[model samples]
Target chain A: MSLLSVRDLTVKFSNRGQSVTALNGISFDIARGERVGVVGESGAGKSITGFAMMNLLSRPGYIDGGQVLFEGKDVLKMSAREQRSLRGNRMAMIFQDPMVTLNPVLTIGQQMVETLRAHRKLSHEEARQIATVKLKEVYIPSPEARLDQYPHELSGGMRQRIVIAMALLLDPQLIIADEPTTALDVTIQADIMELLLEMCRSNMVGLMLITHDLGVVSQVTERTLVMYAGRIIEAGKTRSIINDPQHPYTQGLINALPQQTPPGSRLKQIPGSMPSLNAMPSGCPFHPRCPLANDLCRTTMPKVVQYADVEVACHEVQRLQSDLTSEAAQ
Target chain B: MLQYTFRRTIAVLPTILCLIVICFFLMRLAPGGPFTSERPLPPAIMANVLERYGLDQPLYVQLFTYLKNIFFNFDFGPSFAQRDRDVNDIIAAGFPVTLTYGFWSAVFVLVLGIPLGVIAALRQNSFWDYVMTGFAIFSQIFPNFVLAPLMVLTFTLALGLLPGGGWNGGQWEYVVMPAVALGTSYLANVARITRSSLLEVLGSPYIRTARAKGLPERTIMIRHALKPTLLPVISYMSPVFVYMITGSVFIDVFFSTGGIGQSFIDAAYTRDYSVILGLAILYSVLTFVLNLAVDLAYAAIDPKVRSGLK
Candidate 1:
């Protein structure tokens, strides 16, 4: 059984005078110790999915229909007190901007110890000891001295590391990292991602990484979910999606990745911008941007179906697959 | 800290010197001699009066002598309006009364303003928020002179629970009207600043991070929100404090309290240059000092400032 299952989650936002749909019947699952990569462009409802799972969605935005089952318990049904207990203890979240994630006035150690004391009843001395251990886990040097230094004094990479350290301290079963490494330098990004992957591997922690970077999804995630217009258009094992993309949107995303074959080669990009949540295209949301779009694609939303361990939603995938096989034979 | 104090002190020297020079010259320039009372005095008697205060000397010589006495000896030459009474002694007697009243009002505004603002911001469109905001606006929009009399009429005339004006009955009760009159305006200012700053700080990402950490609502407010909100409030409150210390002439006059404010109004009416200039110099100096203290406070609250100091 999956450790966490989200069944037909749909989130809608009321804007101006209309009920705008942000997430449309998206569903997925995470097995124990699984690393799932949720890839989408900005406003693709990837972050919304993460927030919904945590029950942290902001105002004017509500989960109209969804069941977020964590360990077979419905998160939406949990009391505020129960949710509070689960938030910092059973699941922790690390945000994108490290500078803002940490309070400017508080010392790194103070913030860490407070997090510790919030979920677990411990003496100040015990909390400090745990904080020092977590700081060391994230490879911060001089853990004792760094504890007293405020957020302003720390470097960006160091602060991000400290945030990761705080998340791992409670040994949470699941961690929702929403583009946590996007703000870091390219060089530092690899290191932080490696650190997160290693920690999750060792601790048996399930990670839900939300990002638009396909390369990162390939490197760290075992499973990848391609979301478009607030819906998951394609999802499968990482290798299968990258090597043999079934959905037209997934193929476009992979093709759009910068090529290594030639320096001056023209880069391929998706034709149109992601549609606004205010007014999404009917039938299939990606149909307007799909090259393979036809009359049938415009009139009907495709159903998600399983084929060879991959779940794809497209009417023409079967025809395209056979045509591509014949071309490969030639 | 030393550099801050030295810079502030150096900047104030000119203002102090200008007060001394202008007060000395303008006092001499006032119409009629000091002895020119309703009952006219003879020339021989007036000459002795001028000589006794050293007004008989050359203009420049008299200025130099008075400057030396005030700046070096800390002497505020005897009051010409009231014989045998030293100017310094009169200021000393009156300054404390004004200071006490102003200090109490400052404390009252801070105590009341902060929580009211925090609650209003948290509640936004709620009932108490509207009530407090409306009350604060009404008190501030209505002039203190008008508000003071209304308060006296309500509490003294209608209620018959407290005295109307004077610092009579009890010390605490004496403070009630002046403090309320003074604090009503300042409290409104504090509330407005706090409300705006609180809203901005509440929207900051760190506040969300604070909430995500599962901190209780009250803990999040006092620890994470209040500190940054107070930064702007402190900067605004400093100037208000200085104004209160200098005294609001209308409130003093309406109440008939013999405080420095009343003395200032009397001096300005008669164009008593010594008293006017003395008060001006003291007011300017106090304002300058408070502004410096506010700067230090800014540095203390923000770490960027502390490192910038070095």
Candidate 2:
């Protein structure tokens, strides 16, 4: 069974008498030891998906309809008590801003120990030992000393490592990391990502990495979900998707990468921003900016079409695939 | 940390000196004397009294003399309005009662206000949140003067469960009405601050991390949200705390508590230079000390501040 199967998940917000659908019935699953990256621009509901899956969406934003099945158990159907236990014990999450991810007033040991003791009946000493081990697992040097220090005492990279250590304290089955190293230095970012990937691999923990960095996603995640305007526009093996993106939006994101352009040349950028949820265009969300948009694309949402390894939701991609097949036959 | 404390302590002196100078000059400038009674004493007696207390000296001389007495002997001289009683004796007699009232009021503010604030924030737009918000607004609108009499009427005259006035020989019942009246506004202020501050902190990424860690709501609130919420509340409470301890004069008068607040008002009205000056100095010192305590508390509670100290 998949470690986490988020099926037909929908999240909505009611802001000032208007309803906004933040996550529009998106569905995906992660198996044991699987690493999947969900990449999207800001406001594409990438973080909301992580929050929604955890049942941690704050007010004005809530799970409108969904099935978040962890180990084949519906998370949304669990009682508050059950949900509490399922969290940290079965599933953990890492956040974007490392500096603010850990409680400022609490020592690293206190935070880690508290997380351990929350789901399990462990003594302080036992929890501390476990925390120390976890910290070492994250490659934090002299992990024993780090436990006593507060989040503010550590550098951003160290703090993110501490956060990761806390996430691993309970030996959770699945860890959802949302832009975990977005706030760190470039060098530290790479190091943290490697550490995270290594830890997850060794522990056989499934990872749901939510980020907008296509490069990081390609490097760390085995499978990738490219989201646009709250919908997953494309999904496939990360390498294949990065190498040959089918959806125009996914293509736009890949082409806009700085490495794709030569030295000193302007980077390619997608035309227009992600549409605001309230003003989302009819049918296909990305059709407004798609170079190959047609009348069918403008008014009707395209169904997901499988092309080789990729599952892309775009009429143009489907037409192109069929045209290529017909031409090859001729 | 010790060096910061020492530096803070040394910083108090100039502030106290400045307060003394300002209060001394302002009091002398006011058109009244302690001896200006309806039934005035003979001119000779008045002159003798002024000369004896060294009040007849030039303003500079009197200022210097007052400073010398305070610095060297810690003398606040005799009250000019109430013959034979020194400012020290008056404060000593009244301050304990004021302290008791202030202490209990602070307890009430914290014990009642903080949790209520936390609940209100957690509930956000719930019925309880609206009710607490209304209560906060109501309490703020009704100051100590207005609230004190209303409390006395309700609890004293209407309920008849507690005494209307006086310290009642330092009994617990006597403290309830006065403390509540004195603390109501402060409670409202603190609750409002805590609610807003906690609401802000609840939205912080750390709070989300706590929730993601699977911490129960209570643990998340107390462990992750409470400390940062308190930073703003502590700074806001410091002055209000000193105000409570020095006594809300109207509260003292209405409740007949005979606390330092009443004495302060009486001293001001009669222009009792020594008593007024003494109270001013006391208040100044309290303000400095309370503010220092707040700073220290901030450093202790907030790791960022603690690291900055290092």
Top-lDDT candidate index:
2
Tens-digit lDDT string for candidate 2 (B78-143)? 898888899999999999999999889999998999889888988889998998989988997898
lDDT of 2 at A6: 89
| Model 2 Cα RMSD, 1 decimal | 2.6
Cα misplacement distance, residue A229 of candidate 1 (Å): 2.2
lDDT of 2 at B11: 85
Docking class of 2: high
TM-score of chain A of each: 0.95, 0.97
lDDT string for model 1 (A1-330, tens) is: 898999999998987667888999899999999999999889999999988888877767899997999999999899887887787678888889998888787778778888788888999899999989988888889999999888888888999899899888789989889898999999999999999998899999999999888888899999999999999988999999989888888889888888733578887888998999876788888899999999888988988877555898887875565677799999
Candidate closest to the true structure, highest TM-score = 2
Residues A1-330, candidate 2: write the lDDT tens digits.
888898889999999888899998898989899999999899998999998888998888988897999888999999999998988888999999998788889999998889899989999999999998888878889999998998877899998888888888878899999999889999999999999999899999999999989888988999999998888889999998999889989889989999999989998999888899899999899988989898998899998999868999999888988998999999
TM-scores of the candidates are 0.89, 0.93
For candidate 2, report its TM-score. 0.93
Model 2 misplacement above 4 A: A16-18, A324-330, B1-7, B36-47, B56-61, B153-163
